[model samples]
Target: MRRALTWVVMVAVGIFAAVGLWSAAVDPAPVSAEETAREVSQSLRCPTCAGESIADSSAMLSDAMRQTVDQQVRQGRSADEIRAWFAERYGDQVLLAPPRSGYGWVLWVAPLALVGAAAVVVLLVGGTSTRRRWWAALLVLAVTSLAGVWLLVPQTTPDPQRLKQEDPPQVNAVAVLRDAVDHAPGNAGLRIAFAGALEEVGQDAEAVEAYAAATRLRPLDSDVRYRHAFALVRSDDPGAAREVLEESLHVRQDHAPSLLLLGALVHGEDPDRASALLQQFVQLAPEHPAVDQVTAFLAGQLDEVPAEALP
Candidate 1:
């Protein structure tokens, strides 16, 4: 029995040492841009499709989303930051990963709890004849538990100084726009510029307000109305966007952007009208960057396009 236990100890120590050496010798391979884009896209729902990841969808909107992920990855943004950016534009439903707050903790904790309970049961119910084997199993379990704890624990605390160094303060673009609008209260161009800047910064609600002001100031301006409608769509008010786009169409019947945006906004609820609008957009803007996407939508071939064909 002494000889058997000594052999077991030697084997266990040898295994641990081998594992350590292997880990120390191995370096993780760097992920490629396409690989990073795919990984990030897998975590995001396609903005224009139901029940599909952006990585899996071929719609133009999904293609745009994947490109956004690729750009963010290339810029060295964390996965969490990319997810947050999408959530800001598309809402929390866009994320496949559950939020860390609330019931999300349950999913993270349950697996470790089960492993620990299994370890305890093995310790309590094993027979004496298998004592050595059980001891070895327990030793393995202890190592696994330590590893799990290390992985699950938060690795770093937020340092205010480090954060300041990493992200130097950016000028408040919206605030500057607001000041410009104040100085030129009656300038419709100033209001439209302010709205565009707000939209770029993910202030969709404020952007809608600024766009509305510009639209009211220049009700006959097809471009201003089209921009206002686009802002409304971004702000999650698609119905209002449709109304504004219809009015813009009344002002300029061949406005391609308004037709395209309106078609996208109403596709789910009014496919026939959406198709007509998309067809009109294609006819009016045959050389536009989005023409291929609109043509695919009209032909019902968007779902058949491969993701690689997008960008």
Candidate 2:
């Protein structure tokens, strides 16, 4: 039993040591749709926003654009192919995603070169026994070979149309917005759709125009006004955003997202107002994640305030 326990402990320690070393040596590669979208969005302008990208946008159109990207990725198109297709359609403005050819070749080769250089330095300094050195080289070579095979192997072809069909946009918001604008030639609905898509993709300024158009067309629509206010806030025009939100609330009280966003906006500049609004939000939505986060954040701020400001 003693001998067995000793061996078990030794094995555990070895595993822990190996894992620590492996983790220390390997930098994780980014590989999620969100990460890819962020990377791509940074490079491309939002079609609707003056200078926003789809990755940062909150409008419905931006969501559609991202959905399109997700569909292409699913259909076995390389990231490069997908970006290139957009570039062709919208010109260089569409290529929010990184290029992989020519100057972009550095993105592909730099990581490998860095790893190789580090490994060589480690080997030279570590001074492993001959047998260990040979084994390490062989293992590294095997890993490299496997990676090459994976990258070079032909992928299974998929039908692009079918992939898109599988994931239809929630609102067809992108097309409907475009068509409305084209057909009506100053239609507020169409403008709203266009602006919304731009905002969703991170073009705050463009979204504001659409929201403004929508407000002009339907002065009674508090939702449009609320959206406009948020767009202004997102664009760092807080004074205008507050005015819009106030107008929206006057038209229709008890708006949820607007209220929450208002609370968030006021939190830093006017803690008293922020605290009151956030407290209301917390009471209204105790179970919501946003509520929880806001409550905790507000509590922290309260804790930081001077004794004189507590009241």
Candidate 3:
């Protein structure tokens, strides 16, 4: 019986080690926009909605928040950077995920420590053979259950409401951009710069307007048109985006960025055309940073290529 129990423990340990090794060896699937948005939102509270995560809320503000998360994720920002962006705008209260510092560490550590201590105490206690068997069984069950839960369950930190708060320092990029735009109102370059700053700050609608202005000032510039179309897509006007991208292609037939963006915009509604455009883009810009993602996407390995990977 003792040998049998030892073998059972060894099997469990081997299974756990194999799982750990497999997880370490396998590359995580690229995160899709919706999944990335949902994951970020799960860590954030809806600023305009009460008692709900941004992921769970349908309020317009929550929608904007989700878009910001999606944009940041596509831009390859880390989760901490995205959280910091929200915290800058809405205070630390915007985060549902508790900081891992201070007392927060205790909440995570104490439970597992208690389980370990309990098991140790059970093994150390002097008892009858039946009692020893019972204790051993309980210990095994407890350890197995806890290990399963730790591996399978997504662990959320304690509620942010209960933790101490610190406000993030703010940078008023919009005001700086506005000042620069005012100084050179006719400069298409300045306007594009302003638009990019606005997009970074989660002001998608304003970014679209700024991009439109830049495109108007440089109507013959295919690059400006591509930027405008990309901004339009981010603002959820894919039809208009398509028209602008087509105009860009008319201006410069080999404009790789426009082709790539257009492909992504139409990927859902017209996959054949999208695939052709993406293939053309790959041929035109083989050395571009987005090529790997596009290749992965074309090969059915990824759901979508991130926007930041584009020029």
Candidate 4:
């Protein structure tokens, strides 16, 4: 028994060494292309994180975003075009810096103006009586504090009615999407958009319903199905999420998002299936931001990772 155990260990070590050698032989991605991808990624916030740039985040969504950036960069897309694509997918908040044209100039210039104004007030009051100088200081402090609060503190809940009344609710706000769905109830795309808007507003249950309706309208669309699965997961319906993801995989076996999500959902209950799916995910998306996360998870769970899944 001891000799057999020793032989098995030897074989495993040999296999791993061979796999390592093969993985090392493969060339890495181009350095310039990676640097360009990083530049664009740094400009975009991770959709699933608070103020975290996608380039600097470890979340799976950020990984996917980075992968998109890398692919667009490799395709020779211009920086503005890449940014525009991200904005369309995730909205303008994805861009760290707001546009400077139009009234947006107010957002950029107001703080500087407030500071400069306060400085001038202080200079003017420098030679005044102590009481008068103190009054001027108080006034300046109040104005600066209010300006800071206005620019820094995000509103907890946006007024949907006010946004709805705006000429262009940027097309994806809850009220506008709700109106869009009302006007075109049968449109699968509209349903998906409304569902996304609902998701953004913490209406996960309603989002699930909308996503379900979208899947009913476009049954073979793997994208819609996977998105529905995501909503179901967010709604705390893991069983249904698994079902929807499996259905999506049935439609398109190589769908990476579906594979990644389903693998995570089933990781504890059906580890073998999860491992297979995760292996496929890594195979399909080797450059994903969460590759390290997935790799670490896999190493922790398994006694020995398969050679193909190693690098």
Clash counts for the predictions, in order: 0, 13, 0, 1
The TM-score that candidate 1 achieves is: 0.43
Clashing residue pairs found in predicted model 1: none
| Candidates arranged by lDDT, highest first | 3, 4, 1, 2
> TM per model?
0.43, 0.40, 0.43, 0.43
Which candidate model has the greater lDDT, 2 or 3? 3
Steric clash count of candidate 1:
0
Q: For this target, which candidate reaches the highest TM-score against the unseen true structure?
A: 4
Residue 225's lDDT in candidate 3: 95
Q: What TM-score does model 3 achieve against the real structure?
A: 0.43
Please report, as a residue range, the 10-residue window in candidate 4 with the lowest summed lDDT. Answer: 163-172
Model 1, residue 38: C-alpha shift (Å): 53
For residues 1-311, what per-residue lDDT tens digits would candidate 3 score against the true structure?
A: 67757866876677677656655456343367666667778888765455567687775445555655766787788777887776665566666754444555675556667877887777788387667676766677557655754564444644545432433223344653565465456867768877987898889999999999999999999999998888888888989999999999998989999999998888888888989999999999999889999988999997776777767
The segments of candidate 4 whose C-alpha lies over 4 angstroms from its true place after superposition are 1-172, 301-311
* lDDT (tens digit, per residue) of candidate 2 on 3-30: 5445545655555565555544563333
Stretches of candidate 2 off by over 4 Å are 1-176, 185-188, 301-311
Using lDDT as the measure, which candidate wins?
A: 3
Question: Considering TM-score, which of the candidate structures 3 and 4 is the better prediction for this target?
Answer: 4
| Span of ten consecutive residues with least summed lDDT in model 1 | 154-163
Q: Predict model 4's lDDT versus the native.
A: 0.69
Candidate 1 displacement at residue 149 in angstroms: 71
